[model samples]
Target: MNVLCSESMKIEEEVSDDSGTAAVHSLPTELLVLIFSWLSVEDLALNVSKVCQRWKDSLYFRTLWCDKELIYENSREDLFIFVLSVAPALKQLSLNPLFCGDPAAIVNAICKGPKDIRKVHYNLSLFPAAVASRILGHYKKYVCELHLEGYANKHSSIYRNLDAELGQMSQLRSLKLSGYFDTKWDKKVLERGCLNLHHLDVSLIQDESDSYKPFLDNVKSHLKTLKLPQFKSNVGVLELVSSCTELKEITLCLDDLRCISTLQSLESLHIRWSDGVLKSKMNRFVRDCPVFGNLKELTLFYIPGLLATAIAKQCNKLETLNLHGITSCANIIKSVPSLQKLCIVDRLSLRMRHIQKLPRYIPNLRHLNVLGSFLNKGIPPKIISQLKQELPELVISSEPFVRYTKRGNKGYFTKCTDSSTDCSSDEA
Candidate 1:
């Protein structure tokens, strides 16, 4: 604590030199802009912008704001308008529902501004659907990513307007819809909208109808990644998936694997928590497809020991594996001979024997990440020392919870003790 205070004092002294001859002030504008980019948007608005005329002017550097994500949350409406006018290169915008003022006004402001935005995240419940539709139409030529959160009932007019406008977004590449949407009423519109999408996430929708078939069929030839709501015995959906020859990654319940086994291009697969499929199905899939030779990444929430061993036997070239609720690691280690990274989460039964045997089982492993409730103890320092000695090239990290934050112009992880705070998985 004292060290941190001393460092802060030094930074304050360097920043507020009375003679105005601080070395930092002499840095080039490009270097100064790079330094300010390390700070958060709030810090830029409330702290650095008030520093001096030169620093204030540096904020206008186009590269500084191009990739910055502007999210409207508790900040003033006029401030958003100011940012929208100045940060013309901003590529992503997220309008939060908690904003005190009207969200439509901000959307209106964006429509009149530059069309450089490529991604938008909006909530239908926060504003009128007509306004949302108009904004979509205005930016259809440039916007490539759209994430819409819906709370409308089956009969709401919001779906009708959104569906009609979505069809015109020719540049759309990614679409994610959550909550309730009128899938049946928007079937034709979705087919047109989804024809060019490479990534689709509908895992949070509450519909169980075949409306997904049209969306899937339109993009079957080029879809690369898909996140489905749940794995069901819908033969129509399965048949469509079987024809998605270009699919490279998917997240769904591993209930039936026959359809996906034919995806020779599949590089990654994630089995959701709800997958309670029988082991017989898994064995048959592994036996038939020989463990998807092209598969490089696998995420398993839980699987029987026999099934895990059988799957491992065929995963000789798997590069990354995420295991949750796994009690034993022997069966998993044997198959991934080419594994480079492993993440084990929420398992308490990880023993020292398993840790010591990792190098022998997976000789090419380069990184090991262990996350669980006993994070405070981490891998006992003694075991870590021994493992380091055995595998000097390997990198290891332990954490109780995964969260990211920026500190002193650099990224680092911090433990989360409070439940109210949100933990960002992405790096700051």
Candidate 2:
């Protein structure tokens, strides 16, 4: 009887092991990072990391530790140092004046702890030029992403040393600056150094002169992604942008449709329209503008008129569309059929009917950011519920409130992908 029972138990164990679901441990590292990314950093550290040893290791190593604000929230330098030590696999680290008074000390501590710093962020204006140089000098080889930010604080101002130090970091793939109007430092960095940089975000102080035209001309051929500052230009920066033939993505205004005609390799475009932009120019662009079949992503905020329809009709390959400040449901449903992700904020014409009709038009749509409300009126629960039920595969959610790095003269939105869609950093 004992022999028979033992044999039966062994057989049951074998069957369970063979037929059961795959173990969570077998999941790919990239996929696991994607899953844990859904949780907040507080929840991740306090809750998720305590689950198991494997969970702790995975969280620490695979995940990219961002959110410099969290360091301030904790208010402990030793704790930040501990994080830098354990997360040797850190992909990026951003340090600002909010965290520490001395930028040099912060960089020294981080460099001593982690050697694999892939991206580093600091505002030159926050630190003395020598200290800023020391910070960049530490990550000269490993840092591929550098944001030598500019701040308009009374305590900090940009200097030539900041630009000179940046030119030494040859491995930089992405870079952002406030504006080169202060000196010829802009020309010095790109012309004399940092040859590998492909992405550049520049924000001008005011709408007075085209001081950045020379910098744009210098980087026209080598640069692939460019974000110009937010200046009220009726003519748009098309004249300067036309020279950048290698540009894959751009965010600028368009008072004249003819500006887009010269961009052959353009993939993603964001058009910012203020109150006074001529509707006649937009209409003419829609009617006469050449078909941008390669363009896959487009964003238009506060743009007037029926231009979205015209754009969607023309750019048949458009897969991602972000529109805010007065948009059309009929135009979206009838046109951009290839759209996979759509962001619509505070739509004047968005109704339950449009929500219902949305699925039929864009069957392949997988992500929807239906955010913002009309005055005090919130989005109806029933509409959100229906969307979930009908589009089972779609990941639908409201937008999170974004807290920016609090700088004046910010020009463009920042969104960068490995191969698609370029994002911009804040202006100096």
What are the clash counts of all predictions, listed in order?
0, 6
Off-target runs (Cα >4 Å) in candidate 1 are: 1-20, 23-28, 48-55, 98-100, 152-155, 185-195, 231-233, 373-376, 400-428
lDDT of 2 by residue, 284-329 (tens): 7677666367789988777654766666678788899887775665
Best by lDDT: 1
Per-residue lDDT of candidate 1, residues 1-428 (tens digit): 34334433333234446676556766666767778788877677667768888888887878788778888765467667767776767788886472347666787787887676899887776656677677677778888999987774424655655656766777888989877765453566666563478998887877665655676777778799988776463788888888888899988776746678678888998875454577776687787795367789988777666776676667766899888776556677776778989887755666657877888887877788875624434554555656666666777766423344556656665644433211222110
Model 1 global lDDT (CA atoms, 0 to 1): 0.71
Candidate 2: regions farther than 4 A off: 1-75, 81-87, 98-107, 153-157, 178-181, 186-189, 203-212, 233-237, 256-258, 373-395, 398-428
Return the lDDT, model 1, position 288.
72
TM agreement with the true structure for every prediction: 0.81, 0.67
Top candidate (TM-score):
1
